[model samples]
Structures are given as structure tokens and as C-alpha cells.
Target chain A: MLTAQVLYGLTACVIVALGLRGALLHASLLQRVVAINVMGAGVFMLLIAVAYRGPGLPPDPLPHALVLTGIVVAVSATALALALARRLHAEQDND
Target chain B: MNTTNLLVFDGLLLFSIVGLAWASLATTDERRSVILFMAFGLVLAVAWGRLLAPDVALAEAAIGAGLSGALLLAAVRKQSPGSSHTHANPDRNYSESGAKVVLQWLVTLLCAALAGTLAWALLHALSSAPHDTLPRAISDNLVASGVSNPVTAVLLNFRAYDTLLELAVLLTAVLGIFSLGQTTPGYQPAGPVFDGLVRWLVPVLILTAGYLLWVGAHAPGGAFQAGATLAAAGVVLRLTGRSRIGLPDGFVLRIIMAAGVGVFLLVGLTLLLLGRPFLGYPPAWAGALILLIETAAMLSIAATLLLAFVGGQPQSTAVNAAANRQREENSRC
Candidate 1:
């Protein structure tokens, strides 16, 4: 159980790192959007991990709600980012 | 499973999630990355289940994998490679200078440090912090809160404010997409087979989404999940050329997009003016209010999510109409 908890927490950390690296290193706007979302997922994992009480206890609902809110926020953010990407590409075409 | 087996399985699940996420982000092929991202969402849905959040797991599967994946895929389909303005900009040419490499290293270090701190906080906070028992309070009031499911109760009753703001946020994203710039020519795959598949699937999709919404009162189904399911259907419709990018013209479009937030605010304010708290439904009216709100929210969420995939509304529906006319002409020929 402790291993489950620690492994997930560390996975979150690695995911955040990988995503941040992608966001920084990638040139394409779409890639950046995807990276940022992965980073968001990492944060969500961490939030959910904290909600996991040891052994028999049910996980916390508040964090679940918070993560749900985060998911919605993420979709919208992706939408906006993709929209911006589309516009950027169109602008380049015109030029 | 023994504890050892459980740990190994958990480790593997975490591995797949992190691995998929990395593969999605690290890939040079945009389309492959988007596809991998979808798979990542599905795996994470399982992780949510492992965490014992069925509501979230349901939501993650529908919204994260299904709708979000389609949206990203549509965005991917809309663009031609190397078209973005950044391609022309010198800033993207990071290989030209020694200074740039140094700066890159600095940024990488900073981000890694940020991730490290977050992990440390996660590890320490759980062991040290006196986390309050919020579930007890929620369970204590579950009957009067007007929902049997604790998650639903938290979403629609006790923390109704969060849900209200959430709907507003969805609307805001739709508005942002609308205000951004333009919707590219929509992707309507041309084929009789595609059309037949879409026709067969849409009604089933609608039924499933509605069933999910209705069951949300006592189970893992709810407005967000239902809405995303509907949005997934809309995505299919949009892709198959049955539905256009943006819906009917701007006026109806605005109304549909605004419906969720508009009704939610109205109901919440009505309660406040009637000497109750904002978002406080009368005990007898809770189920009715939730159902009504969820219905409105499902529509609004579906429309907004579909529009978000579409990217933006045009000045008129005429653009889609013209495309339809062209498609008809091609079919006739």
C-alpha cells in the first residue's frame, strides 16, 4: 500500500517533468498544448493521490471534485489553445 | 491478489500512464501524439477507478478520452504541417546560439525543481498535515442535501457554488473560442459508409447520454459525464459531415452555449432572493432542480464542447451551407 502511494506520487513527478520538458523544447503550438495538458494530468494525479487514505478508507470526495473541475478546465484550455494554434497557422498562410 | 501482487499491478498501471503521457508529448508526429494522448486518458480513467472515484472515472473516460481526444484530433486534421506562424519566426530557431542552449538548460532545471517540490509536498503533506474529515460532514447532511450519492451531493448540493462556477467556466471557454479568430474549414469525411455509421450511432449515443444523466442522482452518472458523452456524439456528427463545426447561426448558437450558465445563475439567484442561500434548492425541489440544471447543462456542455472542437463560430451559418451545397454537387456528379 505504501508502495502504491509512493509509486503514484513519483509517477506524477516524472510526468510533470516530461511534460514541462516537452512544452519548453517543442516548437509547435499543438505540441505545447498537449504538453501542458500532460502537466495538468500530473497535477491531477498528485491531487488524487492525496485523497487516497491508507488501506480500507474511502478516498476524499473534495479532491475528486477539485480534479473534476480541473478536467473541465483542461478541456476548455485545450480548446482555446487549439483555436489559437489554428489562427496562427492561418495567419502564416496569409503572409 | 496479495499485497505484493497489488503493488506490482499498481506499479504497472502507473508505468503505462506515465509512459503513454511521455510518448504523447515527446513524439515529433503531431497526429501520433494526439492519438497517444487519448490512450493516456483511458489509462488514467482506470487510475481514477483504482483511487475509488467512480464518478471521476466515468467522467475521465467520457470527457478526457472521448471528447477531448476527438477535439484534439479534429484540430490535428484541420491543420497542415509547418503552417503555424512560429515556423517562420526566428524564436523557434533555438539551435542557432550558445546562449539559447544555456537558457534551455536553465528552463529545464527550473521545471524539474518545480516538479520535485510538488512531489515533496505530496509526500510530506499526507503524513504531516491534519487533513479535515470533510466526508463526515457531507455524509451527515447527505439526506437533507437531497442526493444519495456523496459525489453528486458535493457537486450539486453542498458545493453547488463550485458546480455553478464550473458551468460558467465552460461558457467562458466557448466564448473564448468564439472570440479568438476563426474556425477552419470543418472536417466532414466524405463517404456513404461514414454516413451510414453516423446515422446508426447517433441515436444510441443520445440514449446513453440521457440514461447517464438520469442515473446521476444515485450513481456515477451526472451532468458532466452526460454532457461529454453527448459532445462525443456531436464530434462524430461533425466529423461525418452531418453536423457543421459551429451549430446553427450566431443567435441560436449564443443561446445554446449560454443556457447552462444562464439557468444555473437564475436558479441560484432566485433561491437567494427567496431568503435562501445562493444555489440552495428547497429540500423538496432538489431532485427536480438538479435534473433540470443537468439537462440544461448537458445541452450547453455538448454545444460548447462541440463548438470548442469546431474552434469558432462564423459570422453566419452560410459557410457550412455553402459546403453542404458543394458536397451535394459532388454527390450528384
Candidate 2:
């Protein structure tokens, strides 16, 4: 049987690759945000995949929790960053 | 072969992600880019759910996609119209020199190789022996922790020290943002339609936030989730000019900010006084104590983040009056 881990691992690789490309190639701030987010997703996927090794053993719930917390923190940080960016844009427009 | 099914699923995921990457890379408009990024976050959240990390999925959807998108959009709106001039246009010089292109490819190759090696090493390591001491310890103490969710148990009990530090980091960030110049830039007041909507929506949001906070002890909800919801409400109110900047450095604000840290330190100190190592949970009060701390932490976090977003202390009465007046004006109009 093709295990879920193998599928997730491959997916993670693809995500990371895309994220790196977005980060590097995209000159716009919006594109950079998307790239960083993609990277975060890739990392999260890897964590979940790692948690799914054994059948009898319960999955590693700690990483799930940590990643969950990390997501919220990331969003909050993103929001604040976006606010700053927006203000900068407004100021530039005025100038 | 079951492996074939797995491969197909993996392929689908890979295809979607690759497409998104390509689209994002090709997009020159920063505004559209942020929106696409939000869409990408939502897709990633789905992938997480499929990977059996529902908790992560919830978090990703709410914070990653929802909040982050809002932040990005807000930033885009605030930017100068001229800033759009910086975007790469097809007509412009888009090609790098041969050396730069070669270096870029080399970097991409190196990153891919390193990532592949790391994944392979991890899989190999995990397959062998399979003795995970940390997971074992958590599972063993799950019942004692009085939380069925192993993740919650670990966060609130086993490794609470980390959680405490994380709260500190959040508080620090909020404070840092506060130190930045005036956050509440005076804007033209909202129209009657917007004012009417805020009047109806604020209470509903607060109620939902409370429900989420209470559900967090057992399910996918938690203080962070609740706090974010509450902060959303605060942000809405602030934006509508229903809340004005008040003294951010007021005594009450300081206490609320300190409440989480103070409770944590007190609890740790109490453990030390009882001759146990710091943060060792007392069997009798562990669950209650953790919940109490979490509640305090949630309030402080919500308030801090909201204030940080507001970029100043809100003048509570003025904003409330403005909202009230707007509501009246809406009815009259």
C-alpha cells in the first residue's frame, strides 16, 4: 500500500520548491507574502507527515499543537506587517 | 497498489502547489499577489487537514488565511498609488545576466538537494527502533493532565514553559508595534451603512469569540483562537471610528498585559516553595490552574494584539459615542 507519508512527503517537496521560487522570483511585496506562506505550509505539511509513521502508536500531537499555535502567530504577524505596509503606501501616496 | 493511490494524491497536491507558485511568480501586481497568497494559505490548510492535522488546519484557516489576508489587504490599501510603479512589467528589463541566472539555478538546486536529504534522513531515523520518548511521556500523562487532547496537555502542562515564553514574545511584539509612531491616523469617518453594520456585528463577534474560548479546553478551539476573534471585533470597531486612541500606557493596560506573565511566575514560584521543581504541576490544582492562566493569557493577548493593530490607546467613550451617533444617523437617513 502506498502510505500516506510518502504522498505527503512528495507534496511537501513540491510546496517548498514553489515557495522558494515565489520568494526569489516575485519582486512585489504581495508575492513575497505568498511565498513565505507557501514555505510555512510546506513546513507544516512535513511536520504532519512525520507524525504519521506507526499504526499502533498515537500520532505525535505535540507538533500538531505547536504548528497550530505557529499558524495563529504567523497570521497575527502577517496582519501587523500588512498594516505597516498599507500605512507606508498611504504615506507615499500623500508625499 | 495502495502506493499508487498515494502517489496520485501526492501528484494532485504537487500540481496545485506548482501552479500556485507559477501564478504567484508571474503576477506583477502586489495587490493581486496578496490575494493569491491568501488563496494559497487556504489550500495549504486543506492539505494539512488531509494529512491528519485538523488542529493545524483550523489554525491555518483562521490565522494563516483569514487574518493574514486581512493584514495584507490592509497594507496594500495603505500603500501609495505610485508604489504600483515598482511592479515588474513584461515590457521592462526582466532578464538577469547569464552569471546571475546560473547562480540562481545553483541556489535552487542546493536548496532542493538539502531539503530532500533532510526528509530522507528523518524518515529513515523514524522507521528504525521507533521509540519516541517524548510522545510516550505525553500519552502516559494524558489522563493526569485532565485533557483528552494530547496536544492541549502538552501545551498547557508538559511544556508549559515554552507556552509562557511564547506569550511573552507576543506581548513584546505588541509593545514594539506600540512604540512605532501614531497608529491611529485620523481618517474620514465611516458612512451610515458601515456604521449600521458595525452596530449589529460587534456583539455577535464577541459572543462567538467567547464560545470558541470555552470550547478550546477540549476541541480545536483555544485562547489564541478566541483572542484573535475578539481582536477582529476590536479592529472593526476601531476602523469605524467607534473607538478612538486612548492612553496606551495607562495603569489598567499595564496590569492586563502583565496578568498572564504574573500568574505564570506566581504559579512557578508556588511550586518552588512547595519544594518541587519549577513548573511541576500540583496534582490537585493542575487543570484549574492551567485554565485560569490560559484565560488570563487570552485576555491579555487579545487586548495587546487589538491595541497593537489600533497602534494607540483608544479613547473608549469617544469611540462609543461616535458609534452610537452613527447608529442614530443611520436610522434617520
Measured by DockQ, the strongest candidate is 1
Per-residue lDDT tens digits for candidate 1, residues B1-333, read 688887888988998998899789766777888899999999999998887788888888888887778877777777753453213235674556899888878878988898888778777875675466787787788888667777888888888888888888888887878887656564547599888987888888889999999998888888888888888777787777654533567678778788888888888999999999889888899988988888898889888888887677754667667757865775676
For candidate 2, write residues A1-95 as lDDT tens digits: 12667667656766776677667765555556667777777777777877765344467887887786677566656545554555465456456
DockQ of each: 0.65, 0.48
Q: What share of the true interface contacts does each candidate keep?
A: 0.70, 0.46
Candidate 2 RMSD to the correct structure: 6.4
lDDT of 2 by residue, B55-156 (tens): 677667766776666666655554533365335444432356777678677767876886687567656755576557878888888778856677777777
Q: Runs in model 2 with CA error above 4 Å?
A: A53-58, A76-95, B1-14, B81-100, B126-129, B184-200, B239-241, B244-249, B311-333
Q: On residues A1-95, what C-alpha lDDT tens digit does candidate 1 reach at each position?
A: 35566778778888888888888888777888888888888888887777777667867778888888788878888888888778787667666
lDDT of 1 at B139: 71
After superposition, which runs of candidate 1 have C-alpha atoms over 4 Å from their true positions?
A: B81-97, B188-190, B243-250, B314-333
Residue pairs of candidate 1 with colliding backbone atoms = none
Which ten-residue region of model 1 chain B has the weakest summed lDDT? Answer: B81-90
Give lDDT: candidate 2, residue B274: 91
